[model samples]
Target: MSLSFHIGFNGQCKEAFEFYAEYLNGTIGTMLEFKDSPVAASVTPEWQHKIVHANIVIEQVELAGGDVNPEQYQKPQGFNILLGVKSESKVKSLFEKFAIGGEVVLPPQKTFFSPCYAIVVDRFGVPWKFSCGK
Candidate 1:
């Protein structure tokens, strides 16, 4: 079985996914808003314009995300979306970009398993890990 991750956003699904697609050099295959979905009537008027679902392909991985009601939204914990990059320069660049307006859990550094490794919690509150398995 193939595994994928689905993130829950606090009314920032669209903006977050757009940023991800560009920064990760990924392709967005779907970006359905609540107003365009069948469950439009079930959400509040403000949520109608929010993203109901969005999916992006970063290489072979398909990442999905959606906007949830404020009351149902919670900060992400426990796991991080790890990206195995091939270039050390690329990893450093990504680490800097993600660290802007976000927390840098670990500055890019060489580790036993990878030449470059870093962790950052992005402005959208998503934690990411970057590594170059050289």
Candidate 2:
């Protein structure tokens, strides 16, 4: 079975997915606003425009996310999204792109296990680890 990553955003799901699509060279697969869901009437008018579900496809992997109510939203912790790339340049570029308006946990550097490696938390507060080479 294939695995995918799903994230919860605090009213920024659409913006975050759009950013990921551009930065990761991915395509938006599906986007559904809360207004389009069966529970639309239950959501506040302000939240109707919020994303109910969205998916981004990069290569063969799919990243999914949705907006969560502010009260239920929590800061991400404990784990990070690890992206393995084929080249150092790709890793570096991705790291730089993700670092824009975000925090850089670790700058791109060479390690015994990989040609390039970096850790960053994107503007949406999603932590990512990029590594190049097997």
Candidate 3:
């Protein structure tokens, strides 16, 4: 079976996925809003515009996420989304994009295991580990 990760957001799933699509050269597919769901009536009007589900395809890999109920939302922890790229320049560019309004846990630099590597937590509170030239 193929495995895919489903992330939960407080309310920024749409924005985050859009940003990722742009920087990662991905295509966004199947964006559904809370109002579009069968249980739309159960969600508050304020949350109707929130994303219920979104899929972003990067290099044929699908990344999925959705906005969680406000009461149930929690910051992600313990794991990071690791991205393996083929070029150092691409990794640097992507790292810079992820650094906007984000925390840089580790700046891009040469590593023994790779040509370049970096770690950052994006504005959406998603941690990413980027490496290139493996």
Candidate 4:
């Protein structure tokens, strides 16, 4: 079986996927909103516009996400999605862009691990690890 990750957000699922597309430069596979599902009428009015399922491809990696249902909501945890960059400037640029209004877990710096590495929890509370090969 092939396993895949599905990212979740409080309410910014759509926005986050869209933002990632910019950096990923990949196509959005599909999106199914609550309003388009067979159970659309069963959802709360406030959640009708929220995405129930969506998919995106970045660097050939398929990334999918959706809003969690209250009955089965599971907050995202553990593993951080990593982006391997090719240069220090790229790592620095991405860190700055996503770190706004978020916490910096590790400042971008040269280390034994690599020439440059940084970790940040983005505005959406999703953690990202950036690094480059020496």
> Model 1 off-target regions past 4 Å?
none
lDDT of 4 by residue, 1-134 (tens): 65567887766778888887886576787878899998799889998988888888887788888887666665567889888888999999889888888889998999898899999998877889999988
- State the lDDT of candidate 1 residue by residue for 1-134, as single tens digits: 98779999989989988888888988999999999999999999988999999999899799999998999999899999999988999899999989998899999999999999999999888999999988
Taking all chains together, each candidate's TM-score versus the true structure is 0.95, 0.93, 0.95, 0.89
- Scored by lDDT, model 2 comes in at 0.91
What RMSD does each model have against the real structure? 1.1, 1.3, 1.1, 1.8
Error of 4 at 124 (Å): 1.5
- Write model 3 residue lDDT over 23-123, tens digit each, in one string: 88889998999899997998999999999989999888889999999899988899999999999998899999999999999999999998999999999
Better of 1 and 2 by TM-score: 1
What does candidate 2's lDDT look like per residue over 42-116, in tens digits? 889999999999999988899999998999998788889988989989998998889999999999999898889
Clash list (residue pairs), candidate 2:
none
With candidate 1 superimposed using the best TM-score fit, by how many Å does residue 14's alpha carbon deviate from the native?
Answer: 0.9
- Candidate 3 lDDT (Cα, 0 to 1): 0.92
